[model samples]
Target: MATEGSNSPLRFASVEASVPKITIQFCIQCKWNLRAAYYAQELLQTFSTSLGEVSLRPSTGGVFIVTLETFNQHSVLESHTIWDRKRDGGFPETKELKKKVRDIIDPQRDLGHVDGKKSATNPPAHPANAGHTRELKDVAAQVVDGPVKVSKLQDNRPESLGVQLVQAQNSSKSQDKAECEDCK
Candidate 1:
């Protein structure tokens, strides 16, 4: 029901209760724990045939109401359980360490070639590795320390990004619709 390019998704006038239902249940996991609940909300929003939104707070009962594309058609109501806290927690990343490291060398960036890449090469006390001291140090640092951790940001994985999720959701919807037609 969430057709793009709408001013506001219909949440009223019972506009979402009308979308037709398919045979297979859209979601498998029960909305129980925090993760499950969040996941359920994600799935519902992802798969909803009509405009949909989910809201849950610590103050009220932790349940998600899914208003399907029934807005135009049926005026239906569906509820699912949700989580109390987000599984991925921390803060908005105040700084990105990777960008910081990159900035030390390339104030302006490269031409997409490996050789054109600059390094935050440190000066050596004894210039044995002279020209490549910074490169050596950078490699050594990576080996000694590890990859930078995004401790502040929660669930910053590519799959978790909304753009990627929406792309995947669209592909999945097409496939599901195809499969349903094939079955009939």
Candidate 2:
């Protein structure tokens, strides 16, 4: 039996101390703590294990900067500014921020729709379901009567219903075109 007070020979877990650190310095006078906190939450959520620490430093002068610090091959700490409000001309969108961080931590990651392009490697969340095409078309045929409630269309429907709905709606608008090029 193992004693409760005994010093165990093994340590259960360990954390990597060499992971990169992220710092968001926002203007305290401008009350940008919430903005900084939002970015921190996003980064932590997206790269939970990839980051060592995320710090929110209060600053002044309309400053909003995001810096990533990592040790180089030579063991020298190097800091890179990912985003600077003044230099970038404005605040970054959530998707844009995610892409920026993803590029640094995991470049091969697929952000799907956030990447703004549809490729074989990064396909849509839901593809068209041929088996349900007739049902989707029937729903699309309702446009002749009046405007349809797309929100209510997804109830008790397949996960790919939205993609089909968009295609159906668009095709109805332009009968000559059966494809939804802008579905994404």
Candidate 3:
């Protein structure tokens, strides 16, 4: 098997293109498009290295799968584009993981409630919410004609001060009329 001063053409090609490239192939059902994209993003992060890059260019010819590149370090990825090099490998489709992501991106979450309260965990409440509270109250006031009152809010968190003030003013006016004894 010894050829003097000659490398086989195939061997030469292999050597010339020695930088390992990995092509990962998997079937993704088209129905779950959102889940598919999320999985792709998570998968990319796992394999990203400063050595080169791991990229997924979805195929246009109906063959849809993700590929990874090893930069040809012995090209161990020839068989599988599987890049979980760690002993404790990462799998994307564990049942528990799916549930957690589903909960986080819940589709029906009310935007106002989720982003309303200021908390350490939440991003600061929206800055342009200055007129929101008043708008909400005004909308509510349209249907219900019951006296809407507001109470003093100086020492407490913001609470209604209008209705209470109206009642007090009415009471004081009635008392003045009663004391005057001018009209029954």
Candidate 4:
């Protein structure tokens, strides 16, 4: 018969052997593929041993979502979203993304200098001649203002269901206006 001590080690080993899988999906329509891939690379680099796999799925309609899936006995035990663009509004910073993954993978693990309070309060010193620096918010605004080539026939594509829905709503509004004008 296995003693309590032996069972403890077995239980611990089983728990340690199971690592969660992470999937990050980004909207191709929103031009977020590069951003999603970057985040996937960062997460894989940071939690290589703790993560089972990291997948990048292309989607549409401004979707930028990160999900974690835990498995037990060859079946998914739990699945949850780490972030959603519709809820969070924008891409997360690299450090912030690291923190989120760390929280889920190893809650007790310390991120050393990355999680220090001073690191949060002070900006890292840069070389004097590094040229003008812009805040993240400013850079984000510039990216938003940058021209994006939007295809006029996107509504006809199956991947652009959200675009189709928006077009339908707009046409219904135009039809209502036309009917009201006829009554006048």
Among the numbered candidates, top lDDT falls to 2
In candidate 3, what are the lDDT values of residues 29-89, reduced to their tens digit?
2222344466555533432332133234332222334333332255444333333212224
Q: Could you give the candidate ranking by lDDT, starting with the highest?
A: 2, 4, 3, 1
Every model's TM-score: 0.17, 0.53, 0.24, 0.54
> Per-prediction count of colliding residue pairs?
20, 0, 11, 0
Q: Mind giving the per-residue lDDT tens digits that candidate 4 earns over 1-184?
A: 4577674443333354345878899877556789998999988877787888899998766678998877646664777788887798777888887888788778887776568645565676677523223332343344466633333332233423232112111122343332221122
State the lDDT at 82 in candidate 2: 91
Q: Candidate 1 overall Cα lDDT vs. reference?
A: 0.31
User: Per-residue error at 74 for model 1, in Å?
Assistant: 6.3
lDDT of 2: 0.75
Worst 10 residues of 1 by lDDT: 161-170
Give the runs in model 3 whose Cα sits over 4 Å from its true position.
1-36, 60-64, 71-184
Q: What is the C-alpha RMSD of each candidate to the true structure, in Å?
A: 21.9, 15.5, 24.2, 15.1
Highest-TM-score candidate: 4
Full candidate order by TM-score, most accurate first: 4, 2, 3, 1
